[model samples]
Target: MKVIRFVLAVALLTTLGAIQALEPAPMERFFIEFKPGTGAIIEAGVRADGGQVHHHFKRADALAVSVTSRLAKRLGSDPNIVTMEPDARRYLAAKQALLTSQPLLQSDPFAEQLVPYGVELVQAPLVWDQGFEGEGITVCIIDTGLYEQHEDIDSSFVLGGHSQDPNSQWFEDGDGHGTHVAGTVSAADNDIGVIGVSPGKASLFVVKIFGEDGLWTYASDLVAAAFTCADHGADIISMSLSGSSGPGPERKAFESLYNEEGILSVAAASNGGNRQRVFPASYDSVISVAAVDESKLVADFSNQNKWVELAAPGVGVWSTVPHVSNSWLFTGGNAYQGEPMEYAPDGVVTGQLADGGMCIAAETPGDWSGMAVLCERGEVTFAEKVATVMAGNGSAAVIYNNEPGALLGTLGEEGGWIVAIGIGQQDGQAALDFLGQEATVQSSAPVPGSSYEPWGGTSMATPHVAGVAALLWSANPAWTNVQIREAMDMTAMDLGEPGRDIAYGYGLVQADAALQYLLAKSTE
Candidate 1:
């Protein structure tokens, strides 16, 4: 978008000579810092000059602002202001993560008290037998928010302030990200949904940072939320969001929260499938958590960097979710033909199923958002076909076999990411019967409604570390945050090349081992 605007501005300057100078400068969001007691003074100056103050961190003497580039330059040289940086927007790995969840239409009795693979992988049950289920400990979740009425959460006190609006009640989680992460930290041990590592014993504090879409938030919002966590009685802060850039001030804020407030912070290493250092998690004061599967192997998408501190179960980890309308694909009064093409993301997509002949990159439509595209299988690999649909902003892809019955196939070993479905050759042509009609695609299952769900991401890995930190802290309330972290590092199951390497940080966080580690250290 910025590039497009820049190009337009250049073309205008070339075509129209004198009018170019009258063109308004693009507005940019930034984090502004002023000397102590000067936040009001700096903010006043900004607002008087056609600037908007998004938020004020009175404690840190900082404010997030949006202003023209000209105003920003003027503020930089102002003696009253300390520093300024572009407040970059950090996003949830919504597209990268395999966000698979299905509503069961029927209640299964055997599934009662079902233990999720993640809960078991961290050995939370073993520590439960010792009767130290994160009792009296507090874990703060900084994300969208959680459903207060959720039976599984059972939080004693629900107190949170949205970074978007400091005065607004940040308790409703429109997207299930916060609810799922909260469930992993402290869902009740009741025989309904899956239990959390804390098992209904830990106190929960929250800070809703992400918006309803579960998309992006500025880094400044996250920094402000940390202060809210510390102001409350949170022993640990769990953040499931990540971004590319971390300015000096943001890092300083996290370090101050840990060092000054005695708070332990845990964050996701990101789902980038590469070694790019993502923010919040990559900070020295926060423990960076990576993702592993049920088999305890590192996930393909989990970021691997030297700064990563620990690994936990993140693949297909079952947990709790908020109540939402059924997200199932239906067309022509019947369920859509075909299965979730290998790695389709969980979403509710409703639109026209346009016929795109062979879904080759060259022939793909430029705009396919809010539309399901039907493509013939051939002329390209399934991965390439799906890629074309995704690049064109498609909602879902319906691929039909070139010749034959029902199309039952995979998107190769490395499956595609779009909500892809494989249908028979006849079904593909038949789909045109309702050509212009609306078709839907979603993560659906034939069963009674269920409150539980499963999600995959480094977002899933963060709560594992935070929950274990709470358990270990509760085991010995006398220890400080630093001591608890050191003990965890010492006791974690060593992965990679014998010591702390990139993939699986100190190794998987062990609840029982850390408890024992702290006890042995106390005895010594």
Candidate 2:
């Protein structure tokens, strides 16, 4: 028995040894910095440590390299190395659809809604009333590539663009987020789908840092893109992406661009809904923007912190989308509870919800034939709720927000339902309050040719401020970036607490007010 116990202990030790031997070494992509003009020595040291240099940022005196954790520690001890940190991943700061067969629509159906609520919210129309449509100013959109062919997008206004990834198509946008952002910046005023804040005035220089896969980019690629935009003579750089990391070479690149080239950098403060800072928005050199809804309330999804310097309309923002049959109309009031949800009969449905309040599972399996059912968000997947309503013979579904603001959602292809749309919490609650009363709710697709949709995010808000920056810069070409930033902050309509607060930094961005202030300052 003693011999057996000894043998078991030995076997356990052997197993532990094997486990330790088989453990994978930590490996990561790191950004390393060295003293000026030490590229050759740095490269040699990296190679000696079994690291491969991916990029040489000569301007910033840094290298983006891949190495094992053990090798990184060895390199960190080198006296010549200044900073060696792991390369961070960045993401596009917008919610996007995963799948759909809708082709890009060719005509402008919602031309009547041309001037988006965002444009009016920021008072850009008033700036346009003064004839400053961001002319002669170049704003570089460093994000997913711009869709140059959209009817609302003016290809002529696109000075040019470049893609860092050779596999990506720079002129086309497979993900609709970048195109939507571009339209908000400067979609033409051709009386088409919708007019941009600076229509036909500012020329957009697309720097395609993000690829088709929802724009997941690396820090090295982002640093490269910034320099590329600067070399192309971008007067202002607008980026709607962020990372949870701190100041790095990418942040330095933005600072150099802003201080040396006099280019302004504007970025989103993130949608993390937390106090933690995100970069490059958190960087001092970049102007960080938060999001506000149409009611002038700060969006619940918007990140708030001391770094938040500005705010803009981001919720329920209607703008141009990639030409596809993806438009829908949503209307609800105390009436029209029995209307049939209208949409393409090919199983594609456009519909409205009954005014009978939040339709949870308890209300399902009832007499809802030909009538769209309204469901409150939560407790199940949107598909599940719709499926429940369908089981009861409902024709369509409307998922309303459980929080304060509106939401952009998907019903997924698997859900056996006809059509659906999302509404804000306030609107949803109001409809629910009118339960069993006379109420009307409706949703339908626009004509085939015009394509427009609503999206929400700090990503959407950044373009509004960037476009306004272009407008202000065009209006006052003599003003420096510092002056422009100051004008924006000083003139913003203060929200929340008396002065600047975390939620609504300096209040909402007022284009007309900023321009007026700048005009007044110029006269001085």
Candidate 3:
């Protein structure tokens, strides 16, 4: 009897192993392409197989659902299903590594004028001066949520907004990128903070696609947000996010909104700095914007491709951020160079470097008194270097990079540093080369004022064009999306080989010129 029982147990275990082998892998989400008008049936099949449906697009005959790998395979096998793909994650174009200090209030608000060079470069101010500040026109910023309460952003201008994630607040900006983008598009012209391209008159709407933890979202959420904006009467939609994916259901939705509802869509060309196209920016119906610097030269970080439609200022762009003590750095004399830096400051400190502030060796007492000490970024923690400089009566400290490029650094609480800034390798070496020379280094003091900051990305360029589009639309509400796009393209300040090229598209967008062209055309 014992032998017979052992044989049965062995047979049962083998059968169970076979069953486990047949089980499908797990997948969090999937984009299931269904046959025309068969999405409901497929949705039922997905639910029966332990899957959940997040969204369904009847026009594209697709469903965005979550299922196990085995179930996805099973669904793909169904005759009603055309294809099944895993739902890919998309991200905001802003680079987190480039983030510096949060913008702090300054005691003298007028001391350092809040100048949006992009607005000036694009000549949007010319349109503003003509009394067309996107008045009565609505623009939807489809990105991370907007901080409606920002001093630069007029809350009354908001027409309402929605979020794909139910847990997210539609009006709050957990990730600072959205608020900055909003400020660029239409921050209030209230005279207290930085002004936007469209200024006080344009109606702003926020669609929170990204979650609070990070700047990431799925295609389904983006599609949903686009439709929500269309339903809410958005005349223009500005998207600063992208991914390397082929045309899908989202494209259909954007096309529908454009062709059927007459909404103009603008998206970032991406920050990949390559010819590889990213969508929905690559879509034929959406206008793709590239980034330019203050010089009207294409930014090295901006993506380039035949699909690029326009270029706008994107480097060192100052706009609104969540209110915080953002550290600012300024170097003077022959080594004067400015870039973003990170540090915990007790207060403002100013001084000249001793021995070019190269604290290569342990500093002697009184060596750094009444001066800002300079140190190379190696062989010590930022806090350790700052602490050593402070020990010698240093008023402030500057830590520079040993290699090329800029960096963000942190000095620990124990460092007791009053003020600190990080400089690029070239700037640091210059300071080191001129160690004994008389020069002054200044770190920005935290002033209790506004929540504006400077950031750089192709993401920042999209809004400048969008704001211009709103201004044009406000001036001529009867013009179609195609007409407006054509006017902008025709009137663009031609750059990069004197015609359309991958780098600058129709050169930098000329809002003033485009508006004038549209106005003249109206007479005909």
Q: Which predicted model would earn the best lDDT? A: 1
Q: Which residue pairs overlap in candidate 3's backbone?
A: 102-326, 105-447, 105-449, 351-372, 356-435, 357-374
Model 1 Cα displacement at 144 (Å)? Answer: 1.3
Provide backbone clash counts, one per model: 6, 19, 6
- Residue by residue across 393-413, what tens digits does model 2's lDDT show? 777666666664334455555
RMSD of each: 9.8, 8.9, 8.3
Q: TM-score for model 2?
A: 0.76
Over the stretch 1-524, how does candidate 3's per-residue lDDT look in tens digits?
99999999999999999999988666678777778988888888888877889988876687899887688667768988776776766779874324322221222122343647888888988998788889888999888787777777788889989877678788766778888899899877776667788886899888998886555788777887888888898999999989888446767778888898899999999998899889889888899999987788898989999999999988777788765543433444454433324545444555566643445445445567787667777766766666777677777677777655444555533433566777666777766665545556655543333465557889999999998898899887888898899998999999887799999899899988998899898889
**Model 3 whole-model lDDT (C-alpha atoms):** 0.76
- In candidate 2, position 473 carries an lDDT of 92
Best-to-worst order by TM-score is 3, 2, 1
User: Cα miss at 57, model 2 (Å)?
Assistant: 1.4
Off by over 4 Å in 2: 1-26, 47-50, 96-113, 326-385, 393-450
